[model samples]
Target: MQTLSRWENTPTFFPQFRAALLEHVGSSATVVVIGASDGRLVLPLAAAGHRVIAIERDPVALQGGLVQLPDGTEAHAAGLVERLQQEQLDDRVDIVESDFLDADLPLAARYDAVWTSCSWHYSANHHRPLADFVTRMQDLVRIDGLFGAEFMMPVTARHYLSEHYTSPERLGPYFTDGWNIQLTLRTGQFTELPHIGQPHPHVHRMGALLATRTSSVTTERA
Candidate 1:
């Protein structure tokens, strides 16, 4: 983990990741981004001309990111909706403030793609009972819909503290049956977080997974 300031100084890694994500976003695609700290993913999704529903539990971080955006960006902050709403967006792009674990999946509506990055590691209880979180994520996508995620792997401890390390082998059980393992790679980089003065060290092996649902399901089923 680099200092916050050093990390901020460099161009974000999302741009490249976003390029990969766009391939899965069709013309009528709807998207949901969870744990969207500081709207890093939201800003790009909005800029890419896609409608996105960005969910973040931290109000302070959300507000901090929102304040920096130019006016007229199509984004909203709320909890998941009980029913999907009709809106001008290709699919509704919403920003919800709530815990991803407890969020009402039925309210958020189904999406063409559900993408999360670097945030899943923070799931409660080390993402215990993996089935629950996996099901929640899979539910967000329509049948044959794309699921894209960037998860931290076992080697993360080399760059930062021992607490940040996670192994993909431990994370694999959460995926529903028939999910495709599209990409898995071990890569390392020095992240500079200058906000804390000294650059904190971090090493991470990222696993990028792509999967699709076996059946078409409604929000409630999701």
Candidate 2:
């Protein structure tokens, strides 16, 4: 793995996601990663022959900045673009430097797979409904393409009040008809160590879903 100083020590699925992608899609599929922060998922996919459309909004995660690590030491971090260039994987990825939902993406530019990891639970995303976020991401996947997301399930009291923090079963209705659900996984509430963005211990429950879009279903869009 090409290490990004800021993102170092962040526990992320590296080759596992790649392995899953290979099992579902053929080699060299085009994948759109919804929260491609600091090249964590993007670089690995790119290295494994997948062309990536990485959408990110955070300048610190996208560009670069000084930050404290998970281990409590401050270090200047390499931006996603810079890291891509360094790893020579820049050509394999198209970076959308804007909020995922607000980014100007043509509907025709669908991908083989659309993915997000722990996105949308942030207060920044509270402005939009959870359905809006899922619809937008799912819309980007071509027929028979994969839709994958690892999301934070409700933990705190306020989390239960909001629809954004959800579980795999709770998110099932969004897939509608003709979508084959391939996977649904969840992790029990667990404590996460302090990291750059999160400077203190935090408890969280996470859930993931991987489904395939077999055919289109007409629905009202927000």
Candidate 3:
């Protein structure tokens, strides 16, 4: 096992995201991960013998670069690309270092599973409506493929007004047909320890949804 750096040591915002993958995603499957920062989930999925297409926007997060730690010290740390290379998992991943929403992804691309963690909730993506994000992710899934997302639910008064900070129940209307919602979970507000960019303690509520598209375009239109 490779030793993890401070930033690299950070656990995923959604703990069950991996569990869902292990239980639902098959071995040798090809998975697409949105916001795959620094191989947090990418490395493990690759290590499990799955091919991963990681889309990350930050160049520093995609490639090793200087970073300021939570303790207010600057240090050079390895990124997803470097970690994958060091772990000999480079061949298993195709790293796309561009904004997930704007990246010129191949139209033919489809996967066994597509996952995003606290992605759309970011202010950076607020320029686009939340539905746009879900639609894009949905379009990328093949029939019977899994669509998983762990997001920040409304924790503050201001969050309720922003559609981006929503829950699975609120997103239900998007599932017109041929979609099976396997599980939907939410965590009540909890305080989290600070790390890297988030240098102070904060409270957060999270939500997760695991659904599968049951029919393809041809089948849906039939």
Candidate 4:
């Protein structure tokens, strides 16, 4: 596990990932940002004219800058929200301080795109099955909506390793049911990030996936 501080400060493949997401979802679309600790993705989406719902569980991140969601949950990310306010983007951005897996999100708020950046594995850590996690993610998207995620997984599987860490190739089967997988790449470089139990940086293999929901089991309102 890693702290929210690590997520906020660490540099990853964010620049390129952001560009790809924007291109796929287009401007002025409704977007749901999972694990939006500091509005990195939310600020950009709102700035580009999209209405964004940013979800983060860390209440500490909500300090200084706070916003109330429709359900009355308060979310904070002082620096980023302040920048959005300076750009006059408050009206288009909704911040929710809730756990993505368990939050009782409004079904009517189905989004055009659901994006999680390097934080999706938190579900597996919480004991949720990977299949169920994938299902929950796809449920948030409307028909033909986009889903994108970038996560770190183990390169070589070990018996003692936590189930939360999986091979990059293992992610493929989960997206096949009703998804049009657009991009699936296992990165070549070993990655390092701060971990809770380790004094040194934890290293792992990285993976990125982008898929589109081709069919919806439930009705969605546009």
Candidate 5:
């Protein structure tokens, strides 16, 4: 896997990924990130002036990363809160230490965008049906708001958890009815380093989606 700096240097993913979303959700918008591990996906958005609420289930996992500082020294960046503090970005970020499925988020379309990278596909582990999980994510965003996600698929379908692996073809079916699909990119035959300490690397199939909510759903006004 590329280092954080390398990811940012590319025009393909990472830095560009956030920039692409920024076209729809402005830099100052309020964004909700599900499975926001450490500060990788949400930190740059916060730095760019967005109000970010980062949700993660395992607080311990969030604490295990190295953070490079502006002063030329690197530190053992602890949890999300600590990362925000170390970078002096706590004011724009709200750290939510809870299972996203268990948390009671706002009902009235509170966020401008809802995003997840390689996280939403794990809904199956929690026994939340994929369709239902997609619906719940849609419900989190207001009309015209955006919903974005990147899912990692196993090379052999049966090798991993059933709900964890999703095909590029399977994604659109879940959101087409309720969303104005903005972008769908599916690519494969690449090796991905395991994020959760799998000793050996594995071949991967990756798919990403960016969609805008077009359907109406009732929610109490905040």
Candidate 6:
């Protein structure tokens, strides 16, 4: 795992990923950001005019990032209640800080779309149990809501031995779903990181998927 300091400073690689999400979400939507480390995506979501509920388990990081945001950011520090308070969002976005497994699905809140990027790999129980996590992720979205995620492909021992590193796939089962996969396209040569004092070989293969929930599940209780 990359150090928090390093991960915090590193630039976002998949810029198009964010754009795709914004386009899918539309305007004046409510968004929930789970595993929001340092509010990287939250800022953009809010800036796009979405009432964002940013969820993070690490209080230090959450507080630190929230403090940096300008007023009217509408962030929920450690719970889902703040998400439930936004009245303008109609089946739009709702951020929750609870573990996905522990989240109460029967609550009054729901989202028109749900998005998780490069963060689902850290699911407490689903890290190794990829299939289970995918099912849980599917449950979070309202029928036809969008689900987007990026994960590392599994690596082989021989390949790891040669490469001296592991890819996202090797970490676990976050990539086994039946959704259509889009290969990430990158241009330009690799650049080294001066801070790390090494050639930062930009090596990673990412898969982006969008699925429309076909089930009849409604956002509100009957």
Q: Candidate 1, residues 92-181: lDDT per residue as tens digits?
A: 457677888776667356787787776655635364543455567877777666776666655433423433344445445544364544
Candidate 2 — number of clashing residue pairs?
0
* CA shift of 162, model 5, Å: 1.5
Candidate No. with top TM-score: 2
Model 6 ranges with Cα > 4 A deviation: 1-14, 65-95, 105-109, 123-128, 155-203, 217-222
lDDT by residue (tens digit), candidate 2, 1-222: 656545565544344455567887868899999988898888888888989999999898888888876677888888898899899999999999999888998888778998888888988899988988998988888887888888889988899998889988888887767588888888788888777778888998888888888887743443
What TM-score against the true fold does each predicted structure earn? Answer: 0.64, 0.91, 0.90, 0.74, 0.79, 0.55
Ranking by lDDT: 2, 3, 5, 4, 1, 6
lDDT of each: 0.54, 0.82, 0.80, 0.66, 0.67, 0.46
> How high is the lDDT of residue 216 in model 6?
45
Alpha-carbon RMSD, candidate 4: 7.9
lDDT of 6: 0.46
Rank the models by TM-score, top first.
Answer: 2, 3, 5, 4, 1, 6
The candidate maximizing lDDT is: 2
Question: Which candidate, 3 or 6, has the higher TM-score?
Answer: 3
Which lDDT tens digits does candidate 6 get at residues 111-199?
Answer: 65555555653334344444444556655656445555554332434433332122434322333333322334322333424322223
**Against the correct fold, how does model 1 do in TM-score?**
0.64
| Candidate 1 global CA lDDT score | 0.54
Off by over 4 Å in 5: 1-17, 63-77, 121-126, 159-161, 193-196, 217-222
| Residue 219 displacement (Å), model 5 | 15
